[model samples]
Target: MIIFLRRKMSRSKECLMKYNSKKALLVTGERKLKNTSEKLFSELKVSPFYLNQLSEVLPFLSRENVDIIIFGSDTYQTQKETFSELLQTVSLNYPQSESIILARENDVPFVVSVLKFGSTHYIKYPVGIKELQSLMKSAMATQPAISPRLEKEPGKDSSRFGLIMGKSTKMQQVYAQMRHAAMTDIPVLLIGETGTGKDLAAQTIHQQSERSAQEYLPVNLGSLPNELVASELFGHEKGSFTGATHQHIGVFERATEGTVFLDEIDSVDEKVQISLLRLLEQKKFNRLGGKKTIKTDARIIAASNENLEELLRKGQFRQDLYYRLDVFRITMPPLREKIEDIPMLIEDFLTRFNKLFNKKVKKLDPECLEVLQAYNWPGNVRELKNIIQRAVLLAEGDRLYIHNLPPRLQKTRRSAHSISFRIGTPLDQIEKEVIKETLALTHNNRTQAAKLLGITRRALYNKLNKHKLK
Candidate 1:
């Protein structure tokens, strides 16, 4: 009897708890897909409630014991906001249950965004039983996996961005978004602070995209003259204007069947925005003094440091154009938001400069790397890249040291490396001093420093105000 019971006990440990098929809720209306979804849930032995719209699921969610709620992102075309709102609602109402989005393999951006929004998992289509079983098991766990952000999936490669190297979760999400943008002809709007590698990301999209065989042109809308913006974008016929000595093809035209990167797109004037909007809608434009319509097949990948949505509300941007481009937007995180990626980025830049400047200097000092991590890079990746390159080219030593860094960075090392305290020091005083040191190390970046100090930003702010450091 004891031996027979041991065998049964071992079998139970290997198998997942069987869930009723009716306990599942799927938000899909497509009959074919719904059939497939139903079959998968049946195989997993989980009952599901099928709802067409996201709205139907909300009311049902309050009463039903939904183990897993699955939806297709195709339901939301340009209404990403509504989709997000639905996810938020589900998260609030049913925080314990798992939300799975049934997505296409090419919907990499969509997957990344939703995963960041606290989705537990996703079912990629032509869905298979094995994958579904795995997802089911994860969902049915006593403690469900929540938030797919900075996913450090085992055996997953997060170093595909080449010189923009990263194993960090933030970079992995960026890579996924970039990969998805590259596969489609969709116009991508990159939102991030300056020096966040928006230009690099634009270039990556163009390079990895289907149009890579053609020309890749970059235009800085912020630098273009108001009077000449039209000519620069759409070209001009010979003698069309004072400087139009010969027929010229503009950046948009030059990038036929390719990509045109409009950097600092927020800086575009209302006049240019109108032209851009028309071109995006019609894919056709006329050169100055030319009546003939010239159609372009160029793909657009616009980048900006400012919030385009905010500008749209201010009536500085067109709403229709914003929706078309914004649905597939990719926002790059600031340096402070993903400080874990700094070390790999530093190594990459260091190696590249070593080869470029014909130097053999290697092994960045540990202390030097710590200071680099602590200091908030206002200029983002570009600033760090430039700093590393300079240090690598100028260093006489075989390995990089603190002295190799810039004066501002070097000064930070002193305040960051040590914190003095008395044996009789009060707890509040010690806390204040540590906060000050951390802030100094992070160069007044409250967010990163607060994280380093293991306290909330509000807590750090209150301490700063108390110590009169603000």
Candidate 2:
């Protein structure tokens, strides 16, 4: 009993040693930032130390084994040369503390410069807790002294490691979730509006999964006839149905040792949902007419544009199957939800279409882009891809003009608004106003406004109601 007690105490000590809170130092000139920093660092469970100036940073850094140093842009920009010298001095003297620059959204060029000079990732302003945690976890969890401090080269592959190109926060969250989901064979349900690239996400998941080398079959439940849905999904024997002339392989059986993406799974009848429940629960299913049981190791990735919960309430979907597929569900933002990625998506689609049609359309008319940004995308990325393809094919000059687009695309004129900050404005009020203005700019489009504000739609909704900004 004493031996067991000793072993338990040793284990507890080891855990306590591993649980050492990371130390972080914030060097900023403003007192207001201290409160915000305190809240953030407290949430992260880090030991935070503060200094008013960069000059005082070195002494503290050399004494305390600080894991990271955050330099506020407001102060860093004031004395760029001095701060740069301080960072260089620390790099030479301390050789351990990872340096990070706090930046407002507009400081991209400055951010690029500092990144080259050996600072870590920029923690953008209006730093939500999640973004801070994501960035800091990525920074603090790694070798604080060794990793390269620069972003990757621009000429990355089209789908960079199964990631569709867009550095927008919304897309980044999706990428993070997808990457997390890919590491497991547990069922993943992709919830997104139609044409928001749910299938693309599913394909990426399959490609990134352990089953990458095997077949990936995507069956559209919405397109399949109600009568043939079962036979199509679970296979059929010869003479099983009026048109069943030969034994057939189903998607589930064919996708053994691989993945089967069920697009528009929300549309499947309750009967199909029952079959799905068994497949999800047991990983086993029988053919439509055969007696023999078939087992599969195939991963199921179900996607639905509609709300599955609403369907459950309406008796249109199975609650059991819904819960089963909801294991690691990721919500895909609509194109309008990530309108900031419009240009990136356009560039990708334009390059492909230009090569396909042998057209050299170089750029989009600036006004045309504005029209696109202002318009709400009902059909999402698929719609935008089609528009870009048609524009590339029809565009005769180096630029894609508004006239080349359909009448609906050419319409929608929203008065653009500018967002600016006053010195004495409360940060909370500033945030509220920014949300309100972005909504107005998007013409009351919460999705587009959320994209513009670098926040989730749900977060935007909460803030809107919180601030009572209609």
Q: Top model by TM-score, which number? A: 1
TM-score of candidate 1 versus the correct structure, residues matched by position: 0.64
Superposing all C-alpha atoms, what RMSD in Å does each candidate have to the true structure?
A: 14.2, 13.7
Candidate 1 backbone collisions, by pair: 20-47, 21-46, 21-47, 22-47, 23-47, 24-47, 24-48, 150-169
For model 1, give the 10-residue run with minimal summed lDDT. Answer: 1-10
Give lDDT per model, in order.
Answer: 0.73, 0.74
Where is model 2 more than 4 Å wrong at Cα? 1-163, 414-441, 446-470
lDDT of 1 by residue, 1-470 (tens): 00000000111211223322236787776888787777787777777677888767766765665667777656655567788777765553344456777667676466557665543566677667677667766555532322222122334454756335666667767776665566467789999999888888888877765577799899888897877878889888999989789998888888878899989888777777778888998999888788899899999998889988789889988787777677568888888888878877877777788889998887888888888888777898888988998898789978999888999888767744787787999998888788877776777888888778777779878888888887
Q: Whole-model lDDT, candidate 2?
A: 0.74
- Estimate the overall C-alpha local distance difference test score of candidate 1: 0.73
Q: State TM-scores per candidate.
A: 0.64, 0.62
How much is 348 displaced in model 1, in angstroms?
Answer: 1.0
Residue 134 CA displacement from its true place in model 1, Å: 20
